[model samples]
Target: MFLRNQWYVAAWDYEVDRQPIARTICGEPIVLYRRFDRTLVAMRDACPHRLLPLSMGLKEGDNLRCRYHGLLLDSHGTALEMPHGERVTKHLCARTYPIVERHRFAWIWIGDAELADPALIPDFWPCSHPAWRFDGGYYHIKCDYRLAIDNLMDLTHETYVHQGSIGQPEILAAPIDTRVEDESVFVTRWMPDIDPPPFWRDALKRDGRVDRWQICRFIAPSSVIIDVGVAPVEAGATVENHDQGVRGFVIDALTPESATTSHYFWGMARNFDIDDAGFTARFKAQQGGVFLEDVDVLEAQQRSIEANPDMALRVFAIDVGGTRARQVIDKKLKAQGAAAS
Candidate 1:
């Protein structure tokens, strides 16, 4: 089961233009599109009449026209018109979810509409900040959303998985600073004054080793904001000197589609090269490739878990971050369930 009463990424701002697109969030089918005012509208995809998905319809002006029976529905799911039917039922409206469009993403509330508060939405400031150039895409991940959360919380795997790009032996040797707060967790690992990976080395174009950091913040029910970058060894790589080197923020937002599938929205916001289109292209492509590696491993692990349900997982010192994340998620679920009861 998924935690409701939360805002989940429905789609990127540009993905839903005039045409209707269907996406399953939290295992519930819905259709998404933009109104004439460029506002996002999300509603239950199935028509109450014959259970035909409303997404199988056309966008007529500001409303959605159901193709099967010629039913026109507004953004609020109110039935506007019907084919040759004199009696237009007033209460025949499709279920609609609350939508908040900001930070270049469309967020939808999948729970009690009354409890859908915009303040509950997590903030990824760089996505909308002008000083950073942000680029990212969506991935259809065939694994549990929690798997991605765990993978992100414990990034030591990057040492082996990303050897050709961002990985280095220094990562595994570094000690992590893990902290838990109300509804959130932070897993930070700083590798001070080490040889830069090929990606950062080329980007920074520095002559010698540098100090790097991976400060990951995990928000409950699945969202992570990772601040990553490196500075010259002489610059100290601290908060004040971070601007002296190339740095970026990796923002991850996940929406669960099923017990074994999830929708992943991720991107990087870099402050160093705020206006370089070429760098943006390369950054997005290389970053996408890096995430593909993660997806491959996660899918394989999912298959293994399915094959051996009783298989026990061994935890180590490095797993403390992930273990704590899981505990926090479970606690949130328990509290939410009890409140609903």
Candidate 2:
């Protein structure tokens, strides 16, 4: 079972156009498109008659026409025109979903549309904040979304997975503190006065001893924002507030497409180089490369988990952060189940 009545990102705001696109979220196939007025719409992907995927239909004005028989549906999923001019009734409509475009993302509520409050959407302010430049790409990984959550919550794997780009030996030695507050989980690591990694050195534009930090915050259901950056040793940047340094918030939102497949939206919102479009493009490319490494590891790990079904996964000291996040998910899921019953 998955968390319901919560906002799950469906696509980047830019991904939706007048042409319909099909996406599966929480095992529900959905079709998304922008109306003539540029407002977005999300609805069940199937046509009510014969159950043909509406995403394969043609866009006519703000409505969609099923390619197979030309059954037309308005943006609200109401059947407007029946094929062969047959009389259309209100009961011929398709189901629609609640969608909101915010912080450069389009979010859809998976259940209980009446309970899908816009206020419940995850706070991704850094992506929309005027002071930051944000850009990244998406990946469809063949693995359970929870595995991706675990990978993000536990950064120890970076020592090997991303060693060529952003990894550093100092990260392995840094003491990690995992804490839980309500439904949120925080795993913070502080590496003070250590040699900067190659990525940090390039971003800082100078090589010297620096204080680096990685604060991985998990917002329940499936979102992880990693606060990472470095500052000169003399800068005196503390873990509480680190604006004195060049910092970036690594934005991640995982939407489950199935029990073993996920839609991974990843990006970096940086306070520095806000005006450098070229830098943003270059960095986005580099970041995409780094995440591809993770995709490979995660896909392999998923296959391994399936092959060794008798062997249950184990948790250790390094998994505390992910463990806490899972606990929050389990609690919420239980509450939702009870409410439904």
Measured on C-alpha atoms, candidate 1 has an lDDT of: 0.88
- The number of the candidate with the highest TM-score is 2
Candidate 2 total steric clashes? 0
Off by over 4 Å in 1: 239-241
Residue-by-residue lDDT tens digits, candidate 1, 245-287 = 9889899998899999999999998887678899899889999
Decoy 1 TM-score against native: 0.97
Q: Point out the worst 10-residue segment of candidate 2 by lDDT.
A: 164-173
* lDDT values, one for every candidate: 0.88, 0.94
Per-model TM-score versus the true fold: 0.97, 0.99
Model 2 C-alpha lDDT per residue in residues 153-268, reported as the tens digit of each score: 99999989999888988788889998898889999999999988889889999888999999999997899999999999999999997888799999999999999999999999
